[model samples]
Target: MVVYEGSEEQTNRIFRALADPTRRDIVRRTVSGEASVSELAAAYDMSFAAVQKHVAVLEAAGLVAKEQRGRERIVRGRPEVLRHVHAVLDELELLWRTRMQQLDDLFAQEAEADAATRPHDGTPPPPVP
Candidate 1:
C-alpha cells in the first residue's frame, strides 16, 4: 500500500497495477458498481483464491476497498486511484507533446538552413552531362 509519498516506486506501482488484466477487470467492475467477493469470483474461471489475490493486490494499491458484512465482503473501486493513474498519463502526454514540438521546431530549422545553404539559381547542382 503506497502512502502517496511521491516516490518513483510508488509511481511505478500504479503503472504495474494497470498492466494486469484481472486487476483492470476488477477495477472496471467495481468502479461501475460495487459487488461482493462471490459475485466477482463467479465472473472468472479461476478459483476464488486467485480472484481474492487479485482483489488483495488492488486493495493494497489503494485502488479498491473491501468491507465485511455478515461474512460477505463487498468490494468497491476507488476512483481517486484511477484518477492518479490518469494524472501520471496526462503528465507523460504533456511531456511527449513538448518533445514532439521541439523536434518539429528543429526540423523546421534544418529546412531553413538547407534553403539558406543552397544556391538561389533555381537550377540543379550541375548535371553530369
Candidate 2:
C-alpha cells in the first residue's frame, strides 16, 4: 500500500465524501465556477437541505470552500486540495505499476527456468534436486 502525504483521517474523509454521486457532481460544478447553495439545489431534484448536506460533506473533505455572500452561501472548489488529491492518485498508480513490473519480471524468470529444465527432444524431464 502507498502512504499518501495527508493524514489517514483526512484521506478517509475525502474518499468518503467523493464516493457519493451527488457530491461528485457538486465538486465538478463548483470546480469550474462558484455556485450558490440555492442554485445547486435547483439543479437537483432533492430538497435544498439535502443539497446543503452534500455541500457540507464536500466542505469537510476540503474539496470545496463555502463562503457567505450576503444571504447566499457561495461554494467554490479548492484547486490546491484537488492538486494534492491528484498527487495521491499518481502515487497509487506508480505503486501498482511497480508491482506489475515486478510480477512481469518474476514470470519472465520462471519462464526462463522452465525452458532450461524442459527437454528439447522427447526425453524425460530432469529430476528435482
Candidate 3:
C-alpha cells in the first residue's frame, strides 16, 4: 500500500511544519474550530508576526488553511492532510508488525531445527536457569 500519496516535496513540507511545537499547537487549536490571526496570536507568548509566520508555514504545508474574513485572516485545520499523516504512520506500524512476525517465524524455525538435531537418547536438556 502506498502510504504517502502526496508528492515527496509535500511530505517534507508537512513534516517540517509539524516539527515546530507552536505550529503543532496551532494546528490542534484550529482543528477544533477556526480562529482569526489575532485570536491565535493571543494564545501564545510570541509576537503576532511570529504567530503569523507559524500559520504561514502550516498553510504552506497544507496542514492548515487561511481565508480572508473581512480584515482578519481566519485559520482552520485541514483534516484531510492530517488523515494522510495518519495513513503514513499506520503503514509504518504495519511494516514493523510484519517484521516482528518474520523474526518470530525465523526463531521458531531455528528452534525446530535445533530440536530435530538433538540426540534421541531421551536425555533432557539442562535447566535454563
Candidate 4:
C-alpha cells in the first residue's frame, strides 16, 4: 500500500489533535491569520491554561506553530499540514473507487456468463415475485 508523506504516528497525532472541537476551531481561526495565545483563550469560555493545552496539542501534531513576539506567543496555522491530510484522503478515495469498479466488472462478467448458460427458448423465465 502506498503511504502518505508522514509516518503513521504523525498521522495519528494529527487526527487526535483535530478530534477536539476547540482545537479544530483554533486551527480554523489561525489558518486565516495568526492569533495571539491570549486572543484564542479569550474566544473560548475555558481558562487560558485550557486554551494553552489545546494549542500545545496542535503544535505537537505539527498542524500549528507558535512564535514568541515580545511577551506574547503567536500561533499560526500550517496550511501544508492540511494539504498532506487532503493528499492522504484523496489517495484513499482513489483506492476505494478502483475497488468499486473492479466489483462492478466482476458482477457484469458473472451476469454475462449466467445469460450464456440459460436456455434460448422462446418463452422467458417467470417474473420473480
Candidate 5:
C-alpha cells in the first residue's frame, strides 16, 4: 500500500522502530500520556541506556518525542504519526477488500456459467471442445 505522507526513508524508519516488541510497548505506554525515560526503563528488565536507545530510535522514526523537563526526559507519543499509520493500514485493508470482492464476483460468474452448461436431467455434461 502507498502512504501519501513522508518519504520512503521516513516510512521505513517508522516501520523499523515498530518492528520491536519493546519499542511497540514503549509507544503504547507513552501514547496514553507522557512518561519519563527512567519510568519507562523501570518497567523493563534491561538497562536504562537500552531503554534510552529504544526511545532514540522511536524519536528518529517520529513516532515519539522527548523533551527535557528539568532533570527528567519526558517522552510523549506523537498521536499524529499513529493516526497516519492507521490511515495507511486502512488503505491497505480497503485495497485487499476490493480485490477480494472482485474475485468473489468472478467466481460467481464462473459458477453461473458452469451451472448453465450442466444437464438438467443429471446426465454427465459434454466434454470440453
Candidate 6:
C-alpha cells in the first residue's frame, strides 16, 4: 500500500477532486489560462452542467478558482496546490532513501560474513574477470 504524507483532511479533498478524469481534464485545460464554463465545456464530451460540477469540485479543493463574470464563470487552475503535493512527495522520498540505505548496509554486512566463512586464510577475494 502507498502512504500519503499530506494534510489528512486537505489531501483527502484534493485526491477526491482529482479522482475523476473529467475534473483532471478541466484542470489541464485551465493550466494555460482561465477559461469560461462554456469554453471548458466544449473541450469535453460531457454536458456543460457536468463540467460545471467538476469545476465546483476543483474549486472546493482550492485546486482551481472560479470568478463570476457578467454571464459565465471563469475557472483558473491554482498551481500552488500542486506544489504542496510535490513537497509531500519529496518528504516521502526522503523516508524511502533512508530505508534503502539501511537495506544496503544489511546486504554489505551479509557479504562480509560470507567472505569470512570462505576456505583458507582470511584474505581478500580475487577480482573477477
Model 2 Cα lDDT, one tens digit per residue, 1-129:
445566889888998998999999999999999999999999999999999999999999999999999999999998877777777889989999999999999999999999898999989887899
Better of 1 and 3 by TM-score: 1
Off by over 4 Å in 2: 1-6, 122-129
**Clashes per candidate, residues 3 or more apart or on different chains:** 0, 0, 0, 0, 0, 0
Query: By TM-score, how accurate is candidate 2?
Result: 0.88
Model 6: number of backbone collisions: 0
Residue 10 C-alpha lDDT in model 4: 95
**Tens digit per residue, CA lDDT, model 4, 29-54:** 99999999999999999999999999
TM-score for all models, in order of appearance: 0.87, 0.88, 0.84, 0.82, 0.91, 0.78
lDDT against the true structure, per candidate, is 0.86, 0.91, 0.93, 0.93, 0.95, 0.84
Tens-digit lDDT track of model 5 for 8-125: 8888899899999999999999999899999999999999999999999999999999999999999999999988788878888999999999999999999999999899997999
> Clashes in candidate 4: how many?
0
Worst 10 residues of 6 by lDDT: 1-10
lDDT of 3 at 16: 95
For every candidate, C-alpha RMSD to the true structure in Å = 3.7, 2.8, 3.3, 2.9, 1.8, 5.7
For candidate 6, write residues 1-129 as lDDT tens digits: 234454578787997898898888888888778899999999888898888888988998888999999988999998888777667778889999999999999999999997776756757767669
Model 4, residue 55: distance off in Å is 0.8
TM-score of 4: 0.82
